[model samples]
Target: MDKLTSMNVFVRVAKAGSFAGGARDLDISRAMATKHIMHLEGVLGTRLFNRTTRSLSLTDVGASYLERCQQVLLEVEEMEAAVTHLQTEPRGVLRISAPPVIGSTHIAHAVSEFLKIHSDLTIEMIIQSSPGDLIDEGIDVAIFLGALDDTSMFARKLASSSLVVCGSPDYFEQYGIPETPEDLENHSCLVNWAIAPRNKWLFKGEAGYTGINVSGRMQANVADPIRIAAISGLGLVMLPTYIVGRDIEKGRLKVVLEDYTSPPLDVHAVYPHRKYLSAKVRSFMDFLQEWLEHRVSVIPPVME
Candidate 1:
């Protein structure tokens, strides 16, 4: 049996979790798929799947082998891609993932301009607040804000936006403005639970970086909802300037604690590490860096 072909079939079977499903995906028959798995198990002297009438699942050894198979397949794919497209221009579908607010506001525009420049290239943008598994999703690139927790992936800084603590004038009038980070404890602060550290908001104060535990009636896993709540005078909110800069300019919200700066929100283009990066990924990364630099430069300065 061809080991590489068997590995590919096994991977598809593992991912699909059914012989018929895997066979359909590869355009092969279920009998062929079974033969491949049987060959693999015979060679390894173990069962790869715990088969039953009700369900199909991987055994302990199968789970470990599946991970290695994925890595090998990915490497082989990248190698082939590098050789086939050595001098070819970037063309084909480019998959991207990003936070909803940033994706809709900024990345949408960037992609529009990028597509206009590269006529042969198409884009599939997934607007998700949470960072989903890039490999499982077949995402070519992902736009991330703030610090990245996964160090295994490669990252390139696109731009940075300052975080601002702001509230509606009506809200300030009702609750009074917070004079310091600690004062946030006394005020009802709207929280974007999507951001890390949860209810604890961070700032640079006299004693250096400090986190203030804040509470309010409103909390959400997305930025827009909290922003809407703040605009409606429900509570104070700390958000990136990119989200609230226009609101502040129009006098809908007023930034407080300007003296104490929150950490800058760094935007990044992240991708899985590869020996040879694809032309589509490389070209888009370059385009995004240039696009965002211009975009960030034009943001209206926040008022004191």
Candidate 2:
């Protein structure tokens, strides 16, 4: 009779594929379970289950309802846990979104470490260029690089990453190293469309800030391809130190224009504003900020 109870019973029946099995799991009688499902169907004006003596199956509409019901039940459980303050330790699946570069490298490594500490929690990492609609996409946290455009969602500054312009030994040998940002026009500068001002690379020097309109033989939407191309001596690339830091350390790439400084981009952990911030998200936000700070101190932005 109770809506939440009926929903739970329906979910159990749908999962177990039999009224008796679901009732047994819930410690309720088969008739009662059937009554709950019937009550739900009556309220919704649809048949939730296709009945038979041997097999039980859900109708098309019932299948959709089952998914929604599961989500609702999970939220209700989390809400109660939060209100009671019984969920201090992180639990449940944390869905995160981040750009491809950081997602695969830094954020992914942070999650591995976080999971080791919080064994009760699970994580789902979504790697994409855009942050997208966090609420609509069901993202619990999104690691955002650069400036925050949207003012609606809540964001916490995680860390800042400096940018570097670099190329392979052979590329520098063949094309000559760029002494100033103006010299980039003479060389092939691999472009990453994901970064704003795709055609222009900004730099600050003794003179002042300058935006150089650069062109290249190759350009990609994501940084990896362009980075690889730069490593192969195809062109020079200007990218955040986080993305190219290891490469510079490994001698795979060489940093040029060391005298100049490009504006550092601030990384932020973004999430939709909610009345109750889940323990998992709160813990991760604090953990990641501290983690990145330690990592930055241990590893210099550029080897050269």
C-alpha TM-scores of all predictions: 0.70, 0.69
lDDT of 1 by residue, 69-100 (tens): 99999999999886677436778889999898
Give the range of the ten consecutive residues with the poorest summed lDDT in model 1.
Answer: 295-304
Q: For residues 1-304, write the lDDT of model 2, one tens digit per residue.
A: 7999999999999999999999999999999998999899999999988988899999999999999999999999999877566347688899999998778777888899999999889999999998899999999999988778899999999998777899999999998988988998899999988777779898886687789999999999889999999999999998888778788888999989988888776789999975578889999999999978755423354322
Query: What's the CA error at residue 287 for candidate 2, in Å?
Result: 0.6
**Candidate 1 similarity to native, TM-score:** 0.70
Evaluate model 2: give its TM-score: 0.69
Enumerate residue pairs that collide in model 2. none
Q: Which runs of model 1 end up more than 4 angstroms from their true locations?
A: 1-88, 297-304
User: Which lDDT value does model 1 have at 24?
Assistant: 97
